[model samples]
Target: MKFRLLLSLFIFSIQHLISQTIDKEKLLEYYESQRYADAAQYLQSMYPSDTKDTKSLTQMAYCYMMSGKLPEAEKSYLKVNSIEPENVPVLFSLATINSRRGNKAKARAYLSEIIRLDSLNFNAWKQLAGYGENADERLKYLKKANTLNNTDPDVAYDLSMTYRELKQYPQAYEVLKTAIAADPGNFTLQQAQLPVANQLGKYREVVENGEKLLKENTDANVINEMGQAYFYLKDYQRCAALFKTLEDLGVRNEGTLYFMALSYRELKEYDKAEIYAKKTIDEGISNHTSIYYTALGGIYEQKEQFSNALEAYKRGLTFSSSPTLYYRLGLLYDFNLKQAKNAVNYYNLYLKNKPDPEEKDQIEYAKARIAALTTTKELVKK
Candidate 1:
């Protein structure tokens, strides 16, 4: 019985040695040719599923992955991971396979294990960020990833985006700045920084970086950013010019028209301001038409054009009865136009909208003015 057991053990040892001794040149040739399926098959024929050879199993799994036989690859990788439980590459491969197969929970599990084993794993954190269920969760993962390896451009970009979405503009700007410094030639990073700079009131920085980006690509977003920067910088001429280019390309939206109107108004060019103001109203969304009119009225009011402001507010009432517009109309009539009865009518309209709590001061002023306007006392009584 002892002799028979020894013979069986020797045979098993020999079989394992022979399998390991097989010429690997053919496998190399297959890999060199990018014939991944052939490589996988070659390894599988030499190494059985129950083989204890981790190297062979890992090689087979990689080939299966490259050959697009994901199930086979996953199985092979699982075997390798069982043999070498701390193998990060094996875990990463499993994570990738599960992610591609839409098994997010499994993918996240693998990634979490990787993070638990190697807390500074930058790619693991980045992957977790990608799998995050919401913006805040994404931000949490991305911030960790960025801290792990801030020089990684893709992670930097994603982290910057999450920061921007959370309205954490300063952090977004800092991340993007570091990333752009690391990868000066990445135009996407360059373009992304424009809005962050704008949000932080870094108007000159927006103009500087934005101008450089535009020279490379005429992105409408970059152009708009430059326009906004120029407007805030009080460089109204350049602001109008940039938005005009977007308008000429027929890519103009209400924001474009609004910016153009404001630019011209700031430049004391009332006719052009009115033109863009009308364009803004034309692009007004349904049932929200009064918003554009209010903006237009504001532009005229800022320019001390009281009659035009009156015209704008009254014309706005044709589309929708906006409480803010009603209040503005009442004020104009009470102060500028000297029509107390007209003022009281608009005050009544303003009161009926039940303005938000934020507008309590405006509401109180309207009520006091209504009571004090003696010429409208008869109208108020009726």
Candidate 2:
């Protein structure tokens, strides 16, 4: 009886070992096929307390990482690192996990170690660039990545942006030009090239790329950029057309309205210009309220609506002490309304603001008006 019982116990142990081996084989197959959730389930069931199984542990870590179980993945990765210190794959995995977790400092340390282990790791350098404390540090890492693989469009794009952040538009433009030449079909590279070109005052490039982007997508940003380029190039008709399209698309704002007003004004469409100018003031560009009000007054004046122009300029003075507005008020009162006293008051206000050197003609005109108005006032009193 004792011998039979012992034989039964041995048979049971052999069956248990066979089951575990089969389960492990299934787990590995699942992992190899990228079925991480299945692999994780099998690992949890068969090797619940078996950190000694380094292969299983590594597979489980990757499974956890792929499944978005970040904390669990991090714990598993730490355990794997303890067993095989300085494993490059484990280090890279840890870095990626920490980066997703927003632990940038820890991720940077891991990536630094990876680069130290293998200096030619382009991915490590590229990842490190995003963790830099400043633009200079970012440039250093991005430059290394670009040097390692200049043909990589993504690396070139990142390096170009870093150059743009430092206000090095010429360098940024050159980098993007090279990148676009290499990857001509990449629409993102083409779109990015526009802003840098615009900054360099390459309006021709802006117009060309912007038109191409518009064909693919009528994105409001692209439309605004194209419209601005047209405005700068003195193509008011096209500029107004684009801005009107933006308005139809429900993108009316102070900036778009202001540009629209300017475009229509330049094209002698005073009524349309006045509508947009009024909208710009109502929408309120907080820093440039005076400019918008002045524009409204100018629009009204262009329509020969002197009373409205005077009222607009007077209301604008409540918001800003703009010398140009004061000068315009002086002219309106002197020439349009024939009020010498009011003209003298406004002309003196204009002189007080110390107008720019380019305003020498206006300055001389204001002084003469002040003298003439003062003399006329004295003669009327006598």
Per-model TM-score, in order, reads: 0.69, 0.64
Cα lDDT tens digits for candidate 1, 142-162: 989888888788888888888
lDDT to native, each model: 0.86, 0.84
- Model 2, residue 105: distance off in Å is 2.1
In terms of TM-score, the best-performing candidate is: 1
- Candidate RMSDs in Å, in order, are 13.6, 14.6
Flag regions of model 2 displaced more than 4 Å: 1-20, 28-35, 44-53, 286-382
